[model samples]
Target: MLYAVVDIETTGGHASANGITEVAINIHNENQVVESYTTLINPRQFIPAYITALTGIDNDMVAEAPYFEDVALQIYQLLNEKVFVAHNVNFDYSFLKHHLAAAGYDLNCRKLCTVRLSRKLIPGKASYSLGKLCSALNISIQNRHRAGGDADATSILFNMLLETDHEGVIAEMLKKSSKEQVLPPHLDRASILRLPNQPGVYYFKDNKGKIVYVGKAKNLKKRVISHFTGNKPNKQRQDFLRTIYNVDYVVCGTELMALILEANEIKRLWPENNRAMKRYEHKYDLYVFEDQNGYLRLAIDKHKTNNKSLQSFNSLLEGYNFLNQLIEKYQLCAKLCYLQKTATKCTAHDNGQCFGVCSGIETVAVYNKRLNNALAELQRLQPSFALVDDGREAEELSCLVVENGTFYGMGYFKDKTYLADGLAPIKNDLSIYQSNSYILNLILNHAAEFPQKLYKL
Candidate 1:
């Protein structure tokens, strides 16, 4: 296999916005370097001080050098039909892909990451940075940050991996990549490559632009790639893959937000392939009702969108189990909770577990008071509240708004003063979603840990 061991110094982190200042490619044919190329390219933009300090490539050095557009064709021809190998292949591949696209060349090459290879072949290292790894392995690097020097060092390291690859892990990785290479033909590589590695919700749309599936991911890029690569591709998964023409994602502030948004979007879109999430949409609801004899009773029932529920469960069995706990904790009547069917009295009352609300032995007024207390215990401590959490970035804060025991929506704010007034001024910022038992449970589950501050609205 011809491996193009590549490296590049960029103007910035973003592939679309940034330009490559210097790049190098060392073509290896398993045994030795067969061909090599390196150049300083004028990025057409001023390199930041921090970047120049690291890469040692200043504007003056690249001022008269060929622009990326000028060298795009040559680079494309050299790298095409070769495994695009690099330390962190994505960084180099994304940069090259973006620039090549702009230069009217569609460059699609198979990739092999040396960092990943080293992690598998040479385990238990303190650091994995190219310089650190090379130093630890005693692979000398002359020009630490220069693209050509780094590329040559990486090529040497890649050769070491080739020698040390005893378990055929590299071969397995290539096979996996080969499968992914064809699974979703219409899904563009650029879109998948650009997916941010963060918590988010993603939508898979068909050729007609209809969402066929909705999913949540803690790491958007990793999760989405696993979808296309990791699974064994069962009939259902294969069918799902066939229908997917594109994917779009929304980055969330936290995992909790991503989960909530996923549930909401699944309910809203009712995506055909999202059976798992759809099943949880309205599974079971805990409801409080007044019986014919004017006693407040609690029951677990199949969820309906119109039903006002205290909380939700993914299954009827789960709802029953939770209700059983509440009944025992509060000495609530089994008959009242639909756990007993006897008309005269409940087994709980007979066993002294219940307060005899099922029979005349306990006064109705006293029994009803205890029932109300139990219900109150189940209600949120703060009826209308906002959960303030870390937003997508450091300067912003995420707000999960709940108004009068119902979740309104979620939004982010930079100003602390806006939070003081309670979700009114930032209402425009919030993307409203319908309140559901699942999301209510999401809030309760997250609030259990007390990870975020709660403010009464």
Candidate 2:
């Protein structure tokens, strides 16, 4: 089989925004390199100082060199119908594919990553970077960071992998079903293979085993594999893929439980790649306190971690709207609830809805009693129920419990009789998780759609 072991030095890390400064290709016919090609191309852009420092390729050096378009046809011809090999195959493949397409050439070929091969064949190497791996293998590199030098080094490494692969590991990886071509270079096929096709929260960990991203999926294997399916030549996507070394997951009974677990894990881990959930915060909260006059007062204020809120809202308007409903329903004094700023009696009192508490005609005890009733009603309205759903196993049952307006937690139980007993036994068995507005919304939406699954406590 013919293999085009290729390498390129670029202006930056990503392909879309970056320009290729140089490229090198070595054609190998299984046993040895048959032909070689290398060139410096005018990237048509300014190479960053750090790039120039690393690669020794600057604007002045490539001033009169041919642009990528001038050599696109030659590169395409050399790579066509060959197994495209590279240290990290996708990086070089993406760059060439993008530039070639722009140059009006369609370059399509199978891919082989020497890094993945080394991880399998060489095994137990501390590092697999081009320079380090070459050094460890005693393969000499000429130009170091330059495209031609790295390509030559990679060619020699590929030859060694082919020679050492007695078990036909390379052939196995070349198969369409292997998924080695699309997977992150640092991540192994086994990690993905071991993932259950169940609903769950998956964690993507880096080389040091630090959690970098958290995600929920109804089909864990399908969702996790989807991340590596596309060749998105963006900095964020490329960087995210490069860091993933392992995938770990927790199987849940239902998608709703998976969603809840995902949010909680993201908040707890504070993963670097988790953007939206990390920034999520309940903007407003309903709070109740006693004034010096022994009157109970309610207020909607910005959420504070130190204070416990009766209810949380995503916006101030939502908080006010809910408070308004409580005012109309419980005959609460709008002024006492901080819905009005006027020094005179509140509009509710003028309309005969408020019981003259603002004007001091109503006794504090009576007004306080009414406010307490409203608070009790609000707690009652907060649904305390258990969502019973299909478990990970047929013999087991999954239960998500919310009691007294707060999410208690979730767990799997073998006994179906937990449904008949009170929430106390279920709570004792379940694992407790922090509740957020996002999780509550998901649960409420699920309940609305499938009310039969909901068992009120």
TM-score of each: 0.52, 0.96
| Tens-digit per-residue lDDT, 1-457, candidate 1 | 8989999998887565678999999999988899999999999999999998998999999999999999999999999999888886766776888788889998778777777678768979887789999999999998989999999999999999999998887777677443334335446555687889888999889979999988999999888877765323134654576577789999999888998999888888889988887776667889988878888888999888887888778888899999999899989888878988996899887679987777877776888899788777767453677788888887988888887677888988886678766557767789898877678778866776784577766
The candidate that wins on lDDT is 2
RMSD (CA, Å), each prediction: 20.3, 1.7
Give the lDDT of residue 244 in candidate 1. 77
Candidate 2, which ten residues in sequence have the lowest lDDT sum? 415-424
lDDT for model 1, on a 0 to 1 scale? 0.82
Model 2 TM-score relative to the real fold:
0.96
- The positional error of residue 14 in candidate 2, measured at the CA in angstroms, is 1.2
lDDT of 2 by residue, 267-321 (tens): 8899999998889888899999999999999999999989989999999999999
How many residue pairs clash in all the candidates, one count each? 0, 0
